[model samples]
Target: MKNKTLLTVLSIIGMGLLLGWFILQMKPPHVNEKSTPSANQQAQTKTNSPEEKYIALTPEAQQKAGIRVKVAGPVQIKTVLELPGEIQFNENRVAHVVPRVEGVITAAYKHLGAPVEKGELIAVLESRELADLKSQYYTAIKRRELAQITFDREARLWREKVSAEQDYLAAKTALAEANIVVTAAAQRLLALGLTQDALDTIPQESQSKLSRYPIRAPFDGRVVRKHVVRGEAVKADAELFMIADLSTVWGTITVYTEDLNQVHLGQKVTVRSEELGLEATGTISYLGYLIDAQTRSTQAHVDIPNPEERWRPGLFVTVEVAEKKIPVPVAVAAEAIQTYRNQPVVFVQHGNGFEVRPITLGRRSGNGQWIEMVNGLSAGERYAADNSFVLKSELGEAMAPQ
Candidate 1:
């Protein structure tokens, strides 16, 4: 029985040894420690690497993208007030010509778009009423001449005792009445815009010039509108022409309620027209006291000297008023600012890479073409002046899913 037990125990030991060998064979294969990295080493590699916010571009790519870089620096920041306006006729230089008497138009020497000088004849009128006045003037002159001769003769006769005193006195009285009549007729012609020279030059019994009345220009200007034609009858209150001197024009700016306080007389204003490629400088001449109820704006006038008359009435234009001048430590082109991660960022240049720099912005200039950098930027740092969006786009691509 002792020998059987010993054989059984030896069998058990053999089975245990075989099981141990199988377990050893089933274990994972060995690997080189130097070839594979630890978790801490992988994390250190990630921490040492540069962030994805930067984008590198070749010199050729930058040139092709039209990215212009400029150094941030101090600049003069002007607070300008820009407003929409229109070119208009200067009211002070505009005239509405009118005739003073009812007459038939005999001649028209001026037409629309005609340039005229002061006192230049614009038209001629013929009137029977003028003719009657001239005839009366002539009769008064003749009567006065006859009365003077009679008075002279009667006075001589009375002094020589050849005629009675009563006859001489009566002749003197008739002369006085005749003189009064002549004076009355001369005053009447003067009231009709006829000069003293014209009255004194009237010919005796002149039928040819009696009914002629000339309408002349009041100032040197261009005839913009004409309402009279030859042979057409015009009344005393008729507006015959509209003449305007284009040497100076008005730039009418519509000032909103918010801008009303900023505008004032004597402020320098610049007027520009994109369509005509014209620019002019002038001073604010007027400001309306009342605001328009519908537009909630007021009218401001700038007297622009249009010596060439390039600014025509009704032409739309933009007006820039110089409000105040400000000094800024750091200024940049407005286009340099871009949005990244929902914040304003400007691309700053490194060696061959551009870094996305977040910035705090101050008030933009009234022109909106320049901006002030309050923080996150230093003077002398090279930054993208224009076309920075290309860099921003490249950065987005770099951060995208790989």
Candidate 2:
């Protein structure tokens, strides 16, 4: 009986120890079903928030994205409103030549575009009328001399009481009439556009001198066009050589009527010519008060000196009339302005990736280094300013499917 009780007690202790271990394991709580999500849900999430859409770039990709080519475009360090215009001749330096006499063509000295001095003759007309004038002058002189002789004889007779008062009076009247006739003849010759030399050298049939008319240049200029040829009969006040002096040329530019205030008298200007090369200059000389009612443009004139006569008239030129320097925003090269579905866009850097934003642009620099941003941009935004084009392409492709 004693051996049986010992075996029973040992068995009870083993069962108690097994029960305690089983309670401890149950308290620690081993779950039979899965309480955590699988790996797939962690790897791929579906959400519409920007936070979800943004994917952090790898180290290699971030470095590559930062490495961008430097490109330059117009920047509004100072905003300028450039007005356009063309070249014109100074109005003060233009002149025209015309004939003043009504006669038949005797001879012409200068050709259609020949140069001449101020007192030079243009065309000569042989007037049967002019020859008659000279004859009248000589006849009048002879008559005056005879009249004076008669008056002297009559006066002597009157003093001696041998002549009537009417005879002496008639002799004096004749002398006065002859003097008036001679004066009228000289004025007639002078009206024929001739100098004293020309009048004295007038070709006479008796003298056998050929008739000639010399035309002179009114102002120094190239013959733009001619209207008449030699021996062609032209009427009085006929249009002749159209001459202009080109020492100082006019830059005729058109601007909006509203922009008149931006320009001022004698403002300094920089002139440029593709054909003539660079760094030329001029100044604003005149501004037209009247706006072109039809075109809504005001005409402004700039005078550029043509010392070597290089600036030719009618050459189409581009002008830039600069206004006051005002501060404004501008950005990257032209290439950076990419078109997404016909919308103007630029790539803006955000975190590790980039996003597309629309921008409004203004005038480009002459060298195309910068462009003005009229709108669609704010200050203090870091853009992919230089090589934004490459990323613009990437963003466009990335969003196309979405």
Candidate 3:
């Protein structure tokens, strides 16, 4: 009984030993301590080695891409007040030509868009009314001539004592009355736009020409409107032609009540037409005292020299009034800015290439040609100024999934 109990104990011990050996074989081998890393160490390694993105190009390639580089530095930023406006004729230089006398249009010498010099004949009129006025002037002159001859005879009779004093005085009074009538007739013709030279020639002019009257231009300008045609009967006050001296034009700006305080006469203004690609600079010359009731706005005009006449009247334009000027430490050309990953960025010059740098923007210039860099850029750093889109396109292609 003792031997059997001992055997059972031995068998139990042997089974325990076999199970321990099996566990040892299945376990992994131990590694060197120097080859293994801790959790913190692994995380730190990942953090330190981040993927950097950039574009690589040569100087020749950049030039071929039409990329222009400029140094970032202090820039004069303009605070602009923008307003809507339209090009209009300078009212001071415009004229509404009218005939002073009622007449029929014998000829229309000037047409729309025709240029004329001062005192140039623009039209002719034939009127019996003008003829009657000329006849009265000539009749008065003939009566004055007869009176002068009688006055000479009467003066001689008075001086020589050969005639009665009452007769001589009567003849002298008649002559004086006739001279007054002649003076009145001459004044009447002078008031009808007839020059002194014209009056002197009227008596020598043919009777048919006595009815002819010429309408002349008041100044050097272009005919903008023609209201009369050949054979058309026009009234005395009718506007026959509209002439405008287009050497200068007016850019009429509508100033809202909110912008009134910022606008004033003599302020520098720039007028721009995006569609026509036209631009001009001038100073504010006029401001309206009364505000428009419906628009709740006042008008201001800038007199711009339009020697080329490119600034046509009635063209809608944008007026930018320079309110103030500010100097910024860092600024870049507006065209240099680009959108990347929904963020505003600029291409900064790197060694042999450029790197995309995100930036914070501040105020823009009044001309919209420059932008202030609040951050992510430094003054004196070279950057892409013109055609920066080329760099952006290259970056996009390089980062795109293959």
Candidate 4:
């Protein structure tokens, strides 16, 4: 009985030991609680140990790469009011040439876009009206000559008492009437576009040339429009040609109701055309008092010097009017800012190299040359100003697959 009891006890102990061994085999391998981290702890560690990006460029390399550096500090940020505009001819310098008398265009000396000097002949007209006026003037001159001879004879007779006094008085009256007629005719020709010198030559000119009327340019300019052709008849007050002096141009800007208060005469303006890659500085020359009812906008003009004639009329441009200037604590060149990982970053001068720092941008200058920094930058920080893209390119290559 005792042997059976001991065997039972040993079998019970063996079963207990086998159950414990199976549980141990099913459980995972031993791991130290102190050494292993939880999910939150792992995430925290990863958040703390962020990969830093930098560009390793020497001063010599930077110079060779055309990378310029500048120190950040307080800068004046211009608040600009940008408006769309169009180039136009300066109205004060433009002219519409017209023929003062009705006539046929016998000759057209200038074509469209032809340059003309002041008093240069542009066309000639043959008009019967002009011939009639000349005829009247010459007829009066002949009568005056006859009257003068008669008056001289009458005066001598009156002094010698060889002629009756009544006869002498009648001859003198005829001479005075002739002189008045001649003076009146000359004044009429002067009013008909004839210079005093031209009138003097009328007596020497042939009858065939009496009807010839020359049209002259009033000022130095280019012919922008021509309405009459050779052999074409034109009327008085007809627009013969349009001339414009293109040395200066007008940049006409539309100032909305909201912007009218900000724009004023004598304000400095910058005109830019992206399509032509042209830029010019000017001042507001005119501001309209009336607002257009349809567009709800007022017109303003900037007089831009266009000596090269590059700023042609009808070109669309941007007019930037400087408003108030605000001083910002930090600012950098617009070229210094770049995009990295979908964030705005600037390459700051770090120890022996440049470090990519994210930034919060604020306002930008009216000229787009500088930008204000709201965060991630401070005064006195050295940064890449011009050609900062070189550093960005270098950073990209370094981060690329090796």
Candidate 5:
């Protein structure tokens, strides 16, 4: 009876062990599932390389950051070249005033910075040479008058057969010689810049005023420089004053060798000065044919009208010249482009997220508000037009060395 009881207990334990093993086999195996990645990690993974540059941003986040998206479309872009420039006096309107005669400066009617009109007297001088010429003129006039009286009396006598013909002929020859001397003296005074009116008036005026020389302005302009002072002696060729017409000026740009082909006469240019808060538009008036050996550049002159004389000479400025206009199939706002690793890029909207896209750019508009896409973009593609810098910053923060 004890053996049979033990056997039964063993059989029951064996059945229980089998049942537990089968139940365990029937249950599912445990696995470690991965957690969801954060938005930054996902963006980094998308933009790991240039070929795969992309950013994943939620719609709500994009809206909160003021990111605006627009479709790339056709645009007309002008090829523009910007270069440093300077404002200068128009050489055509500049005058280097000279005395034209040796004299002692008696009075300076116009000083530096004084505006003068055409033909206005600017200075007065006393000349000894002029005094000598006036004396000669007066002596010649008196001699010619006496010769004329003699010739008239001799001619009357000969006509009436009262005087020898040889005597009358001699008197006529003397009168002709006297007239020649008078004409020669007058021409000498004319060469001294004495007008016919001045010559006629000098004979009627006092001898003391005959030596006075007046220097007149050549054009309507302001005296920029005065080289003579009162009581100073000056030579005939001495520069007395420098005058310039400020109504028009020049904006000169240095064009390099590579740019010589693009810049030409009559091309439109826009000039701006940041320091003076000034802007003006002009046309290219002149182009240098020879290049500067030292600078490897040539000059391009633009004529800028300054009716109010606001643009002063020697002011530094910038010039923008539009070389050509081209029609582009795809273009975007200039603000949409961003630099990544020295390459330009734009953000394209992909579903609810944004993808960073690399782009090749062509010519930019004259005003620099728009840019033409040479490649890596297509028309009708939606991109972040404004505030795209936000995505760039976020991506940069995520990719920074941690």
Candidate 6:
């Protein structure tokens, strides 16, 4: 019975050894730690393998891929074209009020910004020259009266043959020459702005003769500039007042040479002012023949109505000139554009990756949202529509010196 029990225990131990050997060899033949897992290898009852190298995932890249993409599309560029400039006055309508004769400015009746009408008295001038002319006129008038009385007597004598014809002719010549003298003196007084009524009053009020000259406003306008004061000597034809008709002022549109073609005479223009929040409608009145040397721009002038006197001569304002529109080729979105050092590139998607391409830009469309391309990008072409700037940075880092 002991020999039979020992035989049974040895038999059980032998079975256990056989089972362990089979389990060890059951792994696929030639299968090793270095081998890549095949489709059939994963089907094994128990197996462990390292991941494939090409398909290996970095933590950073995995996190990036898991994040939601920012959705973007083409936004057309248009409007809000801010052309800079200042306001100006109408050159044709503006006028300067100056004194006609040299004199001392005795009065400053008009304020610097006061409104005045045509022929309204502005100031008075005390002039010695004017007084001298008046004196000459008074002397000539008295001499002319005496000559007339003498001529009447000579005519009566000639008609009765009581005197010789030569005697009468001599008197006639003397009277004629005296009249010419009177005429010359009268012209001097007229040149000095002596009115007919003033001349008549001069002889009766000879003792009241004075040296004052009245200056009148030449036109209906507001006094924008003043160059005279009481007791100040004013020169002849010197600009004492810069009077301007603010009823209408200039709204100048300074368009570049490239945009000059878009404007024409009589084109409707709208002008707005910030000071008074006033809007004035005007028409293109003049187109400048020459371009500004500094700005390289041409001025197109519009005549704006300013009945409320809100828009003054020098207030800065804006002019909106509608330009002609034209269609152009544009790459739908800004995301397609990438920069490579000094050049612009577009990442055109190819297969599963992308390739950078250089492109030329044209006029801005969607005002600035989408830029028009002169060359390179095309419609309906698949491209890296987002994160193009990221690709640009990568290209820069790659091209850096080692």
In the range 39-76, model 4's lDDT, one tens digit per residue, is: 98987775443124767788899899888889999998
- What's the residue-level lDDT of 274 in candidate 5? 93
Q: Would you estimate the TM-scores of all the predictions?
A: 0.73, 0.53, 0.83, 0.84, 0.74, 0.57
Model 6 quality (TM-score): 0.57
lDDT of 1 by residue, 62-116 (tens): 8999999999988778888889999999999999988778899999999899999
Model 5 Cα lDDT, one tens digit per residue, 335-378: 99999888899988888777778899987898888899989889
Tens-digit lDDT track of model 3 for 1-402: 999999999999999999999998896878877598888888767544312246889999999988999999999898898899999999999999988788999999888999999999999998788899999989888888898898889889889999888888888898899989978888888887889899888779898999998989989989999999999998879999999999999999899999999998888788999989999998899999998999999999999999989999999999988888999999999999998888899988988988888899999998788899999999999999999999888888887789
**Candidate 1: which pairs clash?**
none
Off-target runs (Cα >4 Å) in candidate 3 are: 1-52, 58-69, 164-169
Off by over 4 Å in 5: 1-29, 35-70, 83-85, 255-257, 274-277, 289-300, 338-360, 374-377, 382-402
lDDT for model 2, please.
0.63
What TM-score does model 5 achieve against the real structure? 0.74
> Between 2 and 3, whose lDDT is larger?
3
> CA shift at 162, candidate 5, in angstroms?
2.8
Error of 3 at 59 (Å): 5.0
Name the runs in model 2 displaced over 4 angstroms. Answer: 1-81, 103-185, 200-211, 270-280, 327-402
Worst 10 residues of 5 by lDDT: 27-36
Error of 2 at 1 (Å): 49
TM-score of model number 4: 0.84
Query: How many clashing residue pairs are found in candidate 4?
Result: 0
Question: How many collisions between residues are there in candidate 2?
Answer: 10
